[model samples]
Structures are given as structure tokens and as C-alpha cells.
Target: GAGVSQSPSNKVTEKGKDVELRCDPISGHTALYWYRQSLGQGLEFLIYFQGNSAPDKSGLPSDRFSAERTGGSVSTLTIQRTQQEDSAVYLCASSREGGAHYEQYFGPGTRLTVT
Candidate 1:
């Protein structure tokens, strides 16, 4: 499906390393989201971007985690000084406008393993 796509499907980094994850949403979708999933845990919302509005970044766990959307199509999530606890599946999702009620399509996550 041409829904959402993520790069570097798997990543391995040292505890202090930094990693950048990427997401590409569907052609016309207006909402993009990022989530993190630990083993055996549910998806934790990280950030959200809807159209040209200010992004909802309250869900980000720490200042070290940040994301940016360019041209409303591609998004990049950068994790600085990655720690062992930061090892998780980084998932990206996108949906058509209508707020949270609309169904979102998820991308295959980037599995980050911090050693």
C-alpha cells in the first residue's frame, strides 16, 4: 500500500548515538503522526502534525525527541543521545483530515536498538 512509509526499517546504535527516522505520508493526507512502541506495550503517541496548524508535540517524552515536517509530506524524527530505554519501534501514521475520528494508516516501523 502507498499509505505511509518509513526508512531504515531497523537501526542499531550505541547508547549515546543519535538517530533520525523518516516518514512519508500518503499523497493527499493532511494528518501525520509518530508513535513509539516498546516490546509488549501499546503505541505511545509522540507527535502529530495536521495541515498548516501548529503541531501537537505534547506527547513527546523528552526534549531529546523532536520531529519536523517539510512541505506537509515528509517528516523526520530525530532522537538525540539515544539511550537503552529509547530502543523501540518507531511508527509513523497518516490520515485524511477530520481529526482523530478518521482512520490512520500506519507504516512499518523503524526498530531502533540502542546497545
Candidate 2:
């Protein structure tokens, strides 16, 4: 009955450092999505994974960003060589289905700060 859980809630890192943020989706949800939201910006879709099949890494901003989902329930977002521009709220959402699915619940997000 859990909604979604994200770790840290806030992260302060130095430039060029790497950070890993975690997300736990609701039980029995078959789809998971990762999105990045900057201040006053819209949600940017990073990647999505369903079951054990291939993942959609379409919106990954650069090679410095990557993510993986395990057991179709939990996911990790890794930002390599973090930059000041990379400092933003990393939000995670999940649904029981994808594409046509709406009302995807979101996590509290991990606010990454690069200083």
C-alpha cells in the first residue's frame, strides 16, 4: 500500500561528483518512470522500465546520467560528473501501466544540490 519512497530528500554535492538517488514504487506496480524537474521547469522524462524487458532511455540528458530498475519495483538514478546545472529535484513516478496510463503517483523527490 506504499505510494513511493525516495532517499535522502536532499543531497549536496560538489561539482564533478557523482550521486545516486533511489526510488521505491508501490507494490504490484508494473511500470516505473524517472523524471527530472528543475526550478520553474517542466518534468523531463529520463527513462522508463517495465518488467524485465528493455528500458526506454530516451530522455537521458547526457552520458553522465543513467538509471536502472531492479525487481520492477525499485529504481536508482545515477548522475555522473555532476554539474551545477544538474542540481535539481529528481522525481520518480510509477503506474500500474504505461503510455495510456495517467495519474502516475510521484515521490517526494531527492533535491540534489551542486555547490
State TM-scores per candidate. Answer: 0.97, 0.95
Best lDDT among the predictions, by candidate number: 1
Residue pairs with colliding backbones in model 2 are: none
lDDT of 1: 0.94
Question: Pick by TM-score: which candidate is best?
Answer: 1
lDDT of 2 by residue, 1-115 (tens): 7789999899999999999999999888788899999999999999988888899999999999999998777899999999999989999988887764466989999999999
Q: What lDDT does each candidate get? A: 0.94, 0.91
Candidate 1: tens digits of C-alpha lDDT, residues 5-101: 9999999999998899999999899999999999999999999999998999999999999999999999999999999999999999999983888
lDDT score at residue 72, model 1, on the 0-100 scale = 91
lDDT over C-alpha atoms for residue 77 of model 1: 100
Pairing residues by index, what is the TM-score of model 1?
0.97
Q: Ten consecutive residues with minimal summed lDDT in candidate 1?
A: 96-105
